[model samples]
Target: MNDIDDFAQAYVLHRRPFRETSALVALWVENLGLVRAVIKGVAGQSKSAILRNAWLQPFQLIRVQIRGTRDLKTIYKFEPVPTGVVIKGEPLFACTYINELLLFTLNKHEPELHFFSYYQEFLKRITDIFRPDTEIEPALRQKQMIIELRCFEQYLLEAIGYSFDWGSARDENIEVNMAYGFEPGEGFFPQASGLYQGALLIAIAQGQWQTKGALGAARAALRQQLEWVLGRSLHAPSSQGKLMRPENG
Candidate 1:
């Protein structure tokens, strides 16, 4: 246990006041999926930059070193990922939303490295948009962002042991042409009759661009199921299960 302590990385996910001068923080480290640590005297200490308003933005990877304590551990050291890029605008906020979800849903000291890595990669993809020379058009960029977000949502649902099947129904080996609603236990079913739609599944399987409308419809179906699975811990409750709106202009 002592040796393993030296290998942990530091991450600052969320923080709140623990007392008048101290703060409790949620950190996601490489070795530890989520850790609750207290920043002693953060509100009152002049040298508490690491606690008050440090560089621990979500999605920006950092290397952390911590020493375990009887109560709250000490954050020994930390630094930004050398190759990290700053994400701007609504995307950045969306990233924060994801971090909040992880912090809220995950158990402390639990090692969910796969989910952490998925988050790291997602951040990298968004950071690409901030690159100086990328020439992706604004409309195309929005489309790409939506597609990526949808994919991430699916990934999150699956990773958390939720059942979500996008399979479509078909007759005579031909695609089933209809929209379906997603249910937590029942999967995807036709709009009114609770029947499965095979054609939508086929379209998703084929990765056809024409299926954007279908995919959008399917996403709406899944939202209902996901909401139940996510429960009351959903972030940005005012958004109410809707995808964060893309920036205009």
Candidate 2:
């Protein structure tokens, strides 16, 4: 176990009060996958007022100085990276959902720069959607956000090595017109009750979300795949689950 004293970019995934004057924080670092650290004296009167501020909020990009060994680190410095992005209402719930996914999916001390970049892009897209100058109808905006969430979920799976190929399945080419069932830890196979459409799978593979019913299809497919990969169903409590539900959106 080596001590790391360098600064790195990170986003707060979750935080909870520890003792009386400190907090335990889960941070997603650029080169470090997921890091758990204790921020000393943030909850009480201390000089590290920056840690007590909104900069520690989830999805707020920031640079942090981490110290100590692999099991648990201590955050000595926290600085905000402002993007002027504000997430509220349904979008906020969507953010929470993604954060939960990361908390469950990522492991400690692993480096995943690609996943980090995708996460940054996801936040930027959210910021763009809610920008004051952009004109988008409520219904349309909601649809777009859902698609965005699906896209992010797909990328997250890929990053963690749970990706599925849409063009080919188990070393065989997928017929564009055929319906197939998805087998976890294996590729697709033809089945009468298969829930995935070839064209829809292709669209998801190609990152195309504008097609009719594509959003719903992507959501269902990804959720099924993720549950299989994680070995448990995603339990998003009724409230957060409703935000990501296509029918509710």
Candidate 3:
């Protein structure tokens, strides 16, 4: 059966050069999942080429028409969708990180409509917390980024059939002054010298985006789980996942 979408909302996850005038585009379609398509005639300063370059920008929401019988489809049409979700700085890098995550985890042609909405929500929240200038403190901004990332990772893992639970320590509720360790199959358990403390865990469970210690702890736990889930890591996760510009970026 040939999967098709005549008109759909999509976002550009990643784009790289292909041939001369065309490029390979990876789109997260609204009703469909990940779709890799050939976008033709996007080179030079032609009027049409200028439009496609502006519209197909990374993380920009857009409308598209993709059609093909096999795994690789060709983009027949696409246009940008305007929105207030303007992302920059750490949040922008976070967007790339999640884009990489979807590329690694999502299978082509599978319908994950809800996940698409989840992603839109993620961007909105990032936009909400992100300050364009130095209005927010560095520590606070990093903590917020960490919180958003943990939540995003948790949902992604659940969607892929893995659970990285931080709700509690096994059956007992998380206490503010205690330590806890994590097990892959089971959940959290009490450990006097565990990596994360209950104060941090409680803040995490409560969605405390600005709590000290919680940011690093939450990041450490989810990153470990994410690495295990992927069986590896992405391009410089530690640096790419932060506000500081990565060397390559």
Candidate 4:
């Protein structure tokens, strides 16, 4: 948006130190889909700098006043907003997984407003997973995370115009008992021996998360389709451990 002054809520999708006094930030906002911004004096001991530093972090809801007409903008004001989102350990990698996907897949400077709610829902589920009172087993927690990330991956694909047609396979009515394989532009076609079973695919498509084979099939299909869209291996942000295993595809 080419406004002399613009104010909106934003989350830092990705960022790095830029030069001596500024940070190069990639932001996702409701009004401006994706933006790369420069915010200065973040490291200073001054109160404003500290506020900017705290507010301009991933998963925190920060209100900013920015001004620019181009792809890269400048943030001139930071409105304080208290945040309780703390993502760390294994969960941090999952958080970064979706954040990186957003940075890479979304078009810069366009408003995908619905993504704001989509992202917030994701962060809510993530926060619940790490909440101390939840008392979930490690194995079950991992399964919950797999379902959330795969669903988010599907949202990203839909936003980018690669959404799947759940009801049909290769232009024919999808048979729930059959197996199918995904092709880049050709959609899904039935396979006598396929990596994806129609029932599992339907469960995921309908937002129902199940155990064992269903999760496995969902993960495999998403991995293959997402990697195909990116045209490379979808590497999780560097970790000593592996996250979800979508190896069936």
Candidate 5:
């Protein structure tokens, strides 16, 4: 059993007020997966209160020391990661959507270092999209953002053992330009009335995003796959309007 006295690198996924002077936080730690902890005295007028207030926001990377024996641990310290990425606009809502997914998908106490790294890289890519030095056109930028979200969703599903093969194992001569239907628990099958284009399925299987309509195809495919894993529709109410708006319009 890992001791609660040690400090771990983590990112805040979500937080809410627990009582009058404390708050409950969900943290995605480097080696400990998602943890729910109680931050004591954060709402009080103590000297460390201001620091806690600044460091406890969602998506801020921090090093924390927690102590407790029960399911809910008590945070002892907060050390913010310098040079942490700051997100705004549509990316901010996208971040929230991913956070909600993590909260719902991850099991407490299971260490998923690969998924943790995938999350870090995902944030880095989102930050890069908004960088002043980058010169992406507005339409392409929106498409790239959607691609990033879909890629992360795929990674998340695979990490938790819910991944389905994107290619048909029985068909070795499958054409990359034909239409195919995706059956849950089975791979893609060639069909004249299939909903997904062969080029799109191939692109998703290979993680290629340079082709036209790749992003839109990935969005539809991932949405269906994620819905199957979640057993319900994946709804991001806060960003539904913005997400549904056409990128090229």
Candidate 6:
């Protein structure tokens, strides 16, 4: 690829210590899809002086300029976006999930600005709900996480160009309430018994979170679909499973 000078807004997805005093950063860039670049001598550098402010944190928007290398690029400058300082904790984690998915699945240099915007909006919503001093109501937290995850999943599938039959998959008027299965190409389907509720599928596809119960059911179902498609080699972050696990309390 020719050297291109471009200013891209990106979300830091993952970063690893690079060759002697550098870091290899994976980013989901606006209009550029995913790009992996190396930030030279980022560690031990003052956050006030460099791109350290956005290092390894998810849900942060940054303007990045990079010079392409064979494996990774020389990231010239990464400045935190105007909206960067406000996100933290659970909102951060939710963005991390989005980052992780892009890091593992998206092809580099592909443009996906719309999906990136939706991902950003999802994180923005969660950040707005978070109150550090107050104990998070379990019911509310659960509802929020489920809604956000559903949105993420839908965006992912759509970004990858998968267009499943949402109408048939979520047809509530059907007489048979039987257990259904999802193929990689075909969405939910009634083979023997469509036990999967059509309404839940519709709710998830529509991004509707009207009821906690409906959201919870959609969460469980969508999780299964994403996992199966991602396959065993693509492991979810260890923290992601914890966020989804049921609490005894």
For model 3, residues 122-196, the per-residue Cα lDDT tens digits are 888778777556466776776666667778887887776777557688788888899999876576899999998
Candidate 6 residues 23-66, lDDT tens each? Answer: 77777777766777877766656764255734445666888787
Model 6 error, position 216 (Å): 4.2
Worst lDDT run of 10 residues, candidate 5, spans 240-249
lDDT of 2 by residue, 1-249 (tens): 355576789988778888887789888888767888998766655656545556788888888888887677888887888877677766887777777777767742232468888888888888778776768866577777887888787777777777777667667777778787877668677766788777877776677788776777777767778777665566544222432233442
Q: TM-score each candidate.
A: 0.74, 0.86, 0.82, 0.84, 0.84, 0.75
Regions of candidate 4 where Cα sits further than 4 Å from its true position: 4-6, 44-48, 108-111, 135-138, 236-249
RMSD versus native structure for model 2? 3.3
lDDT of candidates 1 onward, in order = 0.58, 0.74, 0.73, 0.72, 0.72, 0.60
Number of the top lDDT candidate: 2
Order the candidates by TM-score, highest first: 2, 5, 4, 3, 6, 1
Could you give me the TM-score of model 5 versus the true structure? 0.84
lDDT of 1 by residue, 161-224 (tens): 7645565422123247664555665565456454445565666556653564655654565556
lDDT against true structure, model 1: 0.58
Report the C-alpha lDDT of model 5 over 1-249, residue by residue, as the tens digit: 245676788988778878888899888888777788998777877778767888788777888987877788888887888755878876877777787667656542242467887787888888888776778876567677877887887777678776666655346544777877776555567788887787767776788887777777666666677666655456533222323222331
Candidates 2 and 5 compared: the better one by lDDT is 2
Worst 10 residues of 3 by lDDT: 240-249
Task: Identify the runs in model 5 with alpha carbons over 4 angstroms from their true place.
Answer: 44-47, 108-111, 169-173, 236-249
RMSD of each: 4.7, 3.3, 4.0, 3.7, 3.6, 4.4
Q: Ten consecutive residues with minimal summed lDDT in candidate 6?
A: 240-249
On a 0 to 100 scale, what is the lDDT of residue 234 in model 6?
Answer: 34
Model 6 ranges with Cα > 4 A deviation:
45-56, 107-111, 131-139, 169-179, 202-208, 211-213, 233-249
- Stretches of candidate 1 exceeding 4 Å from the true structure: 1-4, 17-22, 40-52, 69-72, 107-112, 168-175, 190-198, 233-249
Q: Write the per-residue lDDT of candidate 4 for residues 1-249, one digit (tens) a residue.
A: 775365688888878889876899887866667777888988777897786687777888788888888888988776655655667776776787677666666543232568787888788888888777778876678778777887887777786677777667867877889988878656679998877788877776676787447767666667777777765466653222343333322
**10 residues in a row with least lDDT, candidate 4:** 240-249
- Candidate 3, pairs of clashing residues: none
Q: Cα deviation in Å at residue 96, candidate 5?
A: 0.9
Model 4: lDDT of residue 21: 65
